[model samples]
Target: MSKICGGIFTSHVPGIGKAIAQNLQNDPYWKPFFDGFDPIHRWLAAEKPDVAVVFYNDHGLNFFLDKMPTFAIGAANEYRHEDEGWGIAFARPFQGHADLSWHIIEHVVASEFDPVMCQAMTVDHAVAVPFELCWPGKDAFPTKLIPIAINTVQHPLPSPKRCHDLGKAVGRAIESWGGNEKVVIFGTGGLSHQLEGERAGHINVDYDKFCLRNLAPDPEALLQHDTLDIVELAGSQGVEILNWIAARGALTGSVRELASNYHVPISNTAAATVLLSHSERVLA
Candidate 1:
């Protein structure tokens, strides 16, 4: 059984993760976030976690409206970065964690959650951007990654209950994996930001605050409310909480908030960042 398991919650607002990485290295607004992540970085630097199972959704950037996978697992050797409808593309190609990834796929299959396995997958900003923030250097962050792809941008996304079930299965698989000591799970996405219609630039500081508060302790309350209800309360794109629910489930113990940051009216969306870890290795 794996000895240690934890989670990192963050915002992938375009270049936001990169910005935080810089803050860890320098900037003022980002220092707290960077500081909170320091133990994580140190843990990464020391334990050299063998596997990192990351959960994120794909926008239209990689999968389009015509064909979308509710859940996809990339068993590829490498992943390329792409644009989010913007002219600019992220510069690096992300490396995949193949061994553990395949292990996870097979484990999930036996457990009855059959995810589509892709030998070669191209990830968009949704996955790449936040990763850039979390692990700035490709050569840094020692673990191989298992990318859990969720679809939130397209219409008719998966329900909260479905995502929650997936997380439970992920926890079971990780617990079953006969592995080394280190493992980190990440759920990357939003805290109440809408990216469509005149509702663009919508600021629900109240909703965002509620989410940040509830994310750790009362997640079920958030989950109990329907996805449509959350979307209504949190704007369409705001339904990204499904990703976090899965991350929350993957963790071994209670959730602890280490650091948090929120800013509003950035381009067409409200932006925020949150860093959380499982309760156990609080000192690490």
Candidate 2:
């Protein structure tokens, strides 16, 4: 049976992409955030997962406000990246695991969750930036891709509880698959930062810390806040934390934090990275 190795959660701010393009990682302003990945690099080298199921939000590269599904999963042979007017150089196309994608799609639907299935999709910084941070300077990504896009950009978005439930469903789907592939789950975007409106450029350090502290030990604590409450506390754009909440839901095993780093004011967002390892056996 397939094994879920672990999950990595990080912010997907577009400015991070531009920083990589210009080689600004070591620069003082970016050093602390870039340094956070050092332990993640070591962990990836050791665990070496065969597949990556990414939970991220699409930024107009593939979906728009007019027609956005609450959840979408990619089932393509290859996933490409395009400049979504961010001006960051496009990374090489990532190879997709179509077999696994289909398995997940079938399982999730059987489990009573409807998600749009895309055979051809273009990923934006949400997917690309995290990949670069995980395995910097790679000519090609090491793991086969399964991109799951969540609708954090539109109104009536999935509540934190709903996204968490979706992750639980996906986790069960992976464990039930017959393949022996080792998998890693990624939840990208947000700690806290708001853009636009009168409350633009808002950052909630206290609430961000509360989330980072509880995400591993007690994700249930996060679900108490409805989407509107999250907007009030984390700001409108800060609702991206829903992705992290979903990713944490997928770990059915006993989870332990391997490493974590939190820094503020990265592109007007509270930048954070967390590495969590799951036990080999699922907890009952």
Q: Which candidate is the best by lDDT?
A: 2
Residue pairs clashing in model 2 are none
* Residue 138's lDDT in candidate 2: 53
Which pairs clash in model 1? 17-133
lDDT against the true structure, each candidate = 0.70, 0.92
Stretches of model 2 off by over 4 angstroms after superposition: 280-284
Error of 2 at 35 (Å): 0.6
**Candidate 1 per-residue lDDT over residues 18-133, each given as its tens digit:** 46434444555545444545555655555556666788988776676676888888888788876556665666666676776777788878878868787887877777766666
Tell me each candidate's TM-score. 0.84, 0.97
**How does residue 127 of candidate 2 score in lDDT?**
93
Candidate 2 accuracy as TM-score: 0.97
